[model samples]
Target chain A: MNCRVCKKKAVTAIPRHNTAFCADCFDRYLMDQVRKTIKEFRMFEPDDRILLAVSGGKDSLALWDILTRLELDVLGYHLDLGISEYSRESTEKTRIFAEKRGYRLIVEEIESEAGATLPVIAESTKRPPCSACGLSKRHLFNRAARQYDRQVLATGHNLDDEASRLLGNILHWQDGYLEKQLPALPAEGGLIRKVKPLNRLTEKEMATYAYLNGIDYVIRECPMSADAKQIFYKKILNDIEKESPGTKQFFYFGFLDRSQKMFPYSPEASPPSEKCRMCHQPCYTDICSFCRLRMKLSPFPDPEQFNGTHPDVISLHTED
Target chain B: MPESKEQNPDETESVQENEPRRRAPTPIKVFNAQTGDHLEVPFQKRVSSLLLELGIDSETVLVIQKDSLLLPGDSIDPRFEVEIRPVISGGSGR
Candidate 1:
């Protein structure tokens, strides 16, 4: 079939748009989508240093590629969750990608820095793998951004990811997560702004861009994580998307576009956040989740003795 | 004569002796992980061609046939159910 742009032989088709394009056109289309999303959401200025949270996965790598191509000030930050082979490979891929591009990547080790790895934390607490893993990564990445003095913390959360998360939140009626679900979550207090520029593109689209651009990313699945809720939601969405193309986009982008204005209900009236006494980051209780978790996992003679030693306060949580 | 009787084929144009009158579309099964679609693309085609039929880009998905990733230029054997999983699917996204 002929390409929709140049009428040359088509390389790919976006069935939702009923459009197909050759390699050059497809690349342009993908980058343009990212650019448009960033601009519309006002995620960050070109001058702003975006601390990208990379996991050696296609989504983050693709985000890095597009941001770099746009000549935006972007840096890579990867946390080694110490999941053995998985962490090793992921960190290596992230490092190599940034090195090849001459971009700086800050690596954080969970064990060496936090006194515990994700598996260790999971085993210790009754929290599931995702709960502990998500909590640590969010806090670490936030701290990484603050330490580096970056203005924005960018993540490679794409359309399918957002939609699936939204589905899960809706299914469970998690208004708090739903309220914060958007392309950009405003920076409040000490927390830096969190932006997801690839939210407009699908997981499929991101992978396509990564493959065509020859970005090296980890193809193997993570060794220590399971999201049964997310899996179920994604499957349900996938089934819907199969019948109705662009359902994922409509579900996610629709929420971002019209959620606040449509439903003016303030669902996130939990309580005024007080800064954690130890780290001075905003938290509901006396200590933040990170500080609390750190205290629980710290090996010091007294957890209070190492209060200032555990780095800075942090925040930001995604369903998956 | 016997020769005329033998030569008296159907009024249609003469066809190759070994050739079938038509090439029916081969039925090949496909499973797309992104959309959770189980599809029967009724045709024998290359990976690239099947992608075109499915309205998916060759770069968008990794074609797996019997646990082996298929290349864009590879032909799909109808007997094998090809699993077309999106290359950039959800992972342990922290």
Candidate 2:
């Protein structure tokens, strides 16, 4: 097949777009797609530094490469979940990429700081592994943004992830989650502004981009995510996508375009936030979830003893 | 020499070997990166057919030959080494 843009020998085919592109053209097309997504969502300004939450996977690394190519001020924030060899390999990959490109990176190890690995914490707390992982990431990413004085926190969530999440939410009729499902979530009540610049791209496209551009990423999925419901949803969506090309995009973007307006997001619409007495972070309850988890693990006699004294929060950006 | 009604042993073996070579193709080695499964797939005209034979949806995984992404319609050589990497991933992203 011929390249859609330059008519060169095409190497990759984008079935959803009904087009093919050679290596060089694919790179340009990917960058253009990310650029359009960023601009379309008003994700951030030229000067606003982007703190990318990189998982060392293809999606995150690919986004980091694209954003750097677009010449945006971007910093990488990596959280080591300490899931045995998986965490070790992924952290090493992220470190190597950052050092090779002369990009600044912050690495935080959950086990080292929190005294337990993610799985251990999840097991001890009887919470789902992904839930624990996600909560910790959300708290830390927001904290990292504020600590580094960055305005925006960007995640490498692509079309598949968003679409799958939307499907799950819709299946459960989670109106609150549906309301918060936007590419760009405004910072509210001490939360950092969050954005997903890769929301328009698919995982396969990101993998291909990484492959062609020589961006090395961890190829393995999270070891603890074998039973994650999100994966099940993604599989169902992929099956549907196989039957109907562009169904995932249409369902997700269509929501973003039309249905999203039905559930407008307002800062005041959410539950009121109060400063956690333990960590001083904003949470709906008296103590934030992270602090609550830490309290559960450590069994502090008085919450006041640890007021404004979370070591992980202060030392998150340090090298291991 | 009663021109033996039987073929020479060497000639008979040569014909027997050439018959299978003409009928059967060298299977393509497909490595699944996700599962670390190596499979020998029979030759198919297009990449899509090979994936279908493997029961993999074209949208779910990538079929790569020598670092080049093969479209579903692209013809694949049975002698070429191909890798099937599943693109679906579950992570902490919500």
Candidate 3:
């Protein structure tokens, strides 16, 4: 088999795309898609300081690699949610990747910053592990971007994530979440502008790019992710995608194209995002979920609540 | 190894140094995400053929070697050891 572009021996085949590519061609192919997506959406200016929310995963790492290779002003921001060895290993991976590439990396440890581990909060807090972690990540990513004076925040959220999230939101009839699913969420109310460059790619492609490029990433799924309802939605989308190759893409991008006209998700229609009364971060409600969860956990006062008691590592780093 | 060569002297004579002999189908060690065990299969086998042999669906599992994902049409190569992760069905970036 030969690469469709360069006629070199092909390294892999993407049947859905009707093409095969050698390692070199595949790199070019991946970069082309990212560049095109950025241009189509006018994601960021060349001078924009882009802060990447890297979880030591293939998707985020691949985004960083492409953005850096494109010579854009990009920095890596990692949040360690204190999931024991997984969090430590992920933080180390992020550090190594950034240091090796001569890029600046900022690490925000949840234990040090918020004085609590994710496992501890999951036990004492109102929200589940995944929900708490998601809230923490969002708040910290935005805070880190602001602290570093970055203009944009980029995430590794890919097509499968977006499509599955959309499916899950629709299934639950979550209008607010559906509105927030847009590829680019402009900066407002203490939140930095956020973008999903990987939304143009999928998990498989990101993994291939990371592998071929010799990127060291954490591949194990989070222990807590086994119970996430989002995974069920992903499974459904994956099933549908098998019967129909392009269904996920059409469903996601088509929504991006037509969502506004069908459903008004403008700032006016939705409740205006306001600063969290406690933490001064953007939240729909008066008190942010993270702040409320923290207030609940404050009574326990024991950082080692879930340690050693649960032999099994209950975590949420699924599919990084 | 010596006993095999002695038993098949003619076979040894047939193989020339300049012309490399065709090797048997390459063996692939797969970590079955379902059974959580390592199973070996032929790398030359097509995706559909291997899934059929393993009694798994194409949608339920992903075949990856050194992180290079192989779709349904792509065949595995023996140069790399592959891992078959669970229902994390993977695909094109878009």
Candidate 4:
């Protein structure tokens, strides 16, 4: 079949979409989307120190490559979730990839630093593994960003992830969560500004970019992410997209376009202003959820004694 | 004087006078604890009074009834339990 965009001979078939684009066109399309998102959102300043949250996954590796190619001052931050061999391989790949590209890398192992692993937290909290993993990853990323004095924290959350989260929030009518889910949400009081330059890019395009650009990434899934709600949402969205081409894009971009005015900016409602009590990081409470949970699981002094204090006052209720 | 009053009162009337009136128990409503804001109007108080007791700014507070979502211009009712969840910022507020 002839390439759809460039009229060149197609090398491979895109079975799902049935439309093939030449390698050059595909790369241009992905880069254009990234550039458009950055321009539209004013995501970063020219000299900003962007810390890419790399998970050795396709989405993040592609993001790192694209940002580096764009000549943005970017580094990589990888949090090892300590998932047996899976985490070890992911971190190794991340380190190797960063070293190959001559990019500075910061790696934090939750097990070593927090003295607790995801399995331990999941068992103790009786919650899904992804919940604890996400909490820990977020905490570690934010803390590391501050320590490194990075201006922005970029995640590899693609169109699929954003759409699923949007759908979930809409299903529950969570205004607070919806407010937090915007592409270019205000940095708020204490939070370092975060930007998703790939918010406009799709999963397929990201994978294609990574594949075509020869970016080394781990293809395995997170062991603990097997039963994640996002996986379900992604399947549902993919099914809908199969029925109607560009449906996901329409839903996501349409929401951002039409609902722009509905969400009025509340300057007073900044995120960073909420300081973490214990670590004094930018958090909603005195102590962050990670620190609070860690302290709860730790064999430190009286847990109740720390309750209602600046950092520990956030969650007094123990799961058990 | 006490002896005359006792002589004038009927036994049934005295028994009725000695009985105490019973009142209904007040309902307690808990708000969304995630935000740590709770609004409770004890069956006998105004919302402003409750806010004063909670040490919250009455003007900035969104007084919501128990089990109902907060909306604009909704009057605070004593019959409904109120829960107030504070909206927390995402990060440090500069």
Top lDDT model = 2
Comparing candidate 2 with candidate 3, which one achieves the higher TM-score?
2
| Model 4 chain A worst lDDT run, 10 consecutive residues | A311-320
DockQ of each: 0.19, 0.47, 0.10, 0.01
For candidate 3, the lDDT comes to: 0.74
Candidates 1 and 4, the one with greater DockQ: 1
**Chain B TM-score of model 1, please?**
0.67
Cα miss at A156, model 4 (Å)?
A: 0.8
- Name the weakest run of 10 consecutive residues (lDDT summed) in model 2 chain A: A300-309
Clashing pairs in 2: none
Label model 2 with its docking quality class.
acceptable
Better of 3 and 4 by TM-score: 3
- In model 3, what lDDT does residue A185 have? 84
Candidate lDDT (C-alpha), each: 0.76, 0.85, 0.74, 0.67
Give one digit per residue, the lDDT tens place, for model 2 in A165-282.
9999999999888888899988878888899999999988899888887888888788899998999999998888777888999999999997656887576567437877666777
Q: What is the TM-score of chain B in candidate 2?
A: 0.70
Question: Which candidate's TM-score is highest?
Answer: 2
TM-score ranking from best candidate downward: 2, 3, 1, 4
Model 2, C-alpha of A315: deviation from truth (Å) = 27
The pairs that clash in candidate 1 are B26-B43
Measured with C-alpha atoms, the lDDT of residue A298 in candidate 4 is: 71
For all candidates, what are the clash counts? 1, 0, 5, 33
Per-residue alpha-carbon lDDT of candidate 3 for residues A147-209, written as tens digits (9 for 90 to 100): 889999998888878898888778898877787778888887677888988787777777778
